[model samples]
Target: MRSNCLPFRADSAAATAEFVRPQRYALRASHSIARCSGLIAAVMLAGCMSAPPSIDAPTTRASTAAIDLPLADPSAGVDMSLPAQRPESLPSNSALARDFMELSFSLESGRAIPQFSRFEGPITVSLGAGAPASAPRELARLVSRLRGEAGVPISVGASAQNHIQIDFVPRKQMSREVPNAACFVVPNVSGWDDYRAARRTARGDWTQVKQRVSATVFIPAEATPQEVRDCLHEETSQALGPLNDLYRLPNSVWNDDNFHTVLTRYDMIQLRATYAAELHSGMSAPEVQAKLPAVFARLNPAGGAVRGLRDDPTPRAYVSAVNRAIGPGNTGARRAAAMSAINLAAAQGWNDTRAAFGWFALGRLSVQNDPETALNAFAKAGNIYRATPGAGIQSAHVDMQLAAFALSAGRAQDAIALVNRAMTPALSGENAALMATLYFIRAEAYDTLGNPAQAQQARVDSAQWARYGFGSDAAVRARAAEVAALARAGRG
Candidate 1:
């Protein structure tokens, strides 16, 4: 109930901007933006196209002569450098932020256990009625230390009868927990009658003990598993001890089922990708289908439905589902549920947005198997976000997602047009940063369309936009290699 512990509204959050704290903290951290390798890689990674689509005819542009402008050299003003900026230090609430970031990431990447392999939960102390006034301060230090040591935060809340309740904030929707009664027992806490009653009932019940804590993690529903994962890890590390412990943690504390459930959908998506790759290489679709079910079975129970297979028993199911619903198609519930698992994985301090996005891409692929439907789905997702304020989604980002979908569906014109429309100042910031991203999307679309000169121009525009977004020449210059690769491919 603290004033500073504000509720986050998804619709109001800016996607392309970072929130910089006013006072700098002396902390060190490392992160890498994953690069997409191909269809499989893209599915597992964030900001990737949904699926493959055939390239279509060019739509008529307004006019070439009217749009004439000098194209700058891609090399002249590029920034290809990685700057080492000092991390901001925290004074009071620093522990919470740092641990939340780390545990979140580890969860998303399927490496949660390894990341939090050495955390020792705090020795919780309970106070009776009229205990010293130092309880709250001591509790705060414990919370901070746990956050600093585990690189994850502990959520503090009012016990049922006014007693203070403390527990780790889960990184994902699903996570494993140890038996609370025996593992970390606290005695009678003072001034909270309701809490005492609840604790009396929870003394031997692990499930009930967990229920005492609220699900207070800050991850949004729309957050990709990877983002949630990274945030948890960063935050967890920030909360742990002054010294670090990277190995030799607890075994009785581990929960494999919890881990497996969260990653099930992603594993299925990867299996599908592997199957598709095998077919693309030389194997037949039927052969891939025959072998793929085994992978699916591994994810599901002994006699249940396959965890991540999207296509119906036959391709007809997908086609019929799409034909029946022109508006938004079916909800990818299973895929979404799987993505939710990242919250738990994140508790251990891993970041893996790629895997989360990949799962979503698979769900999208199932509902919209073709270009038109996929485009509509992206548009619908945007609309869904716009209509709901705290839905934890950004409508603007839908533009980028639509472009990726168009590229995969071979609808170059659609992709290009969407980017162009979204590039308007009224619609977005349209500054160098946004313009740079738009240009990149446009270039990808143009390259897909077999327009070399236009693609080259788009690349140059992209570099300019990058300059505006990053404010660093080194960063923009590094994009040259990608531009050159696209040019070479387009030429071929």
Candidate 2:
């Protein structure tokens, strides 16, 4: 989710948790508002790097000096990780076209974007005051991807006019102004003060901008390195490309139904198309829509294969229901909201990821209060995820939830099997938190089965990645204790 001037991002397997941010939004690292021992908090919006301001970017290297950085570099010690890139299943041009229109024409608020917007020349990025040690390394890596994958002419910070400034404001201050925003990007603002004054006025609105002159992305200064990095991927992507996030999108960070923490292949294609020569700033919605067929035909020729499902538009009621279910509210209300979202998805005849997400949300919200209902919801979500393409990670998330219940019920073998099924996809997704939780669960299951050696190994692996996922030695230990307690409470 992004917030400075937009709505907060929602999550899936990772819509993965909480729904939109209030006012301008912040993208949470995971979707689940609450992650206990087993729930893998599904958010962690799409993911980073540094390069010169150029249309041409590297094939592998993210920064020119990335490899040359001294051993003393601070990021050398940061335990952050990125998943390996996997090939994408292409959406037909027809599907791509509809997504493009929706993404370009309106915001999550349903407010219209009067015209298209993009920087007309090379864009430079700079880290502003109070940015943490982790930012530069992450920014460089992202810049590399933007240039190489998205084909955007972006570079490291410069004093020049074409620029995007990223400021890491303390979370408290951000929460006051942005409210619920985890982080966000805004057009025409250069710093926090600029955001403060312009935020309530038209100056900060994305829809008002025709050609993006300069923008600023506001992030939480005190957030963990991983959290900060997650914000960078989401807010920065919006600063460069589309402003709206669609729930119907199965892939791409552009959709809040789910997330890709690091920009997915789908996101790269969209960005590449955004910067393609055929389009430009100030084009009308219809104009951009008209040109996208040729754009997709050339840029994503694979999508030309066949027509796609091209699902119907998601209703405002459904979106609102999911948001309430995942967001702050009383337990009864949250449950009611979850139920409403489920009914709405069914009524819409959604047999897709969107529906699976609603079920996932119900399972998550019910885990604490309605055990039987939670299990059944998880089962339903798991079934749909299994049948869906590119939803292995989502299935893994459902497995994570079910393994917890199984462990609590003394089903050690069941817990172990579910953990095993989820582990690979968790690793492939580079979701350290989910991976950490899974390892912890595995360790507990091994111990229940009287496998001390395996349990010890799992604990060791859990600690290793927990540092990356949970951040800091103390945080890792705390998370371990939480999971350890869950196991202790289980009937082994």
Q: Which candidate is the best by lDDT?
A: 2
The best candidate by TM-score is: 2
Error of 1 at 439 (Å): 1.2
Cα lDDT, all candidates: 0.31, 0.66
For each candidate in turn, the TM-score is 0.28, 0.83
RMSD (Cα, Å) of candidate 2?
11.0
> Which whole-number lDDT from 0 to 100 does residue 423 have in model 2?
71
Q: How far in Å is the alpha carbon of 3 misplaced in model 2?
A: 7.5
Candidate 2: count of backbone clashes, pairs at least 3 residues apart or interchain: 45
Cα RMSDs of all predictions?
23.1, 11.0
lDDT of 2 at 17: 30
Over 1-492, each residue of candidate 2 has an lDDT whose tens digit, in order, gives: 543221111112232132221111111211222233232221111111110011111122211111221222223334434355556576677877778778877888888998998889889998998888778888998899999988999999775666899898877888787564667788888788888889778899888898988988888777655566667888888898888887667666666654355677777888888899999999998788778878888987776642443547889998888777766557688888888988988898888888887887777666554555666777888888778776767777777776666555555676677777777666655566677677777777778888988877777666545545555554454445444544554542
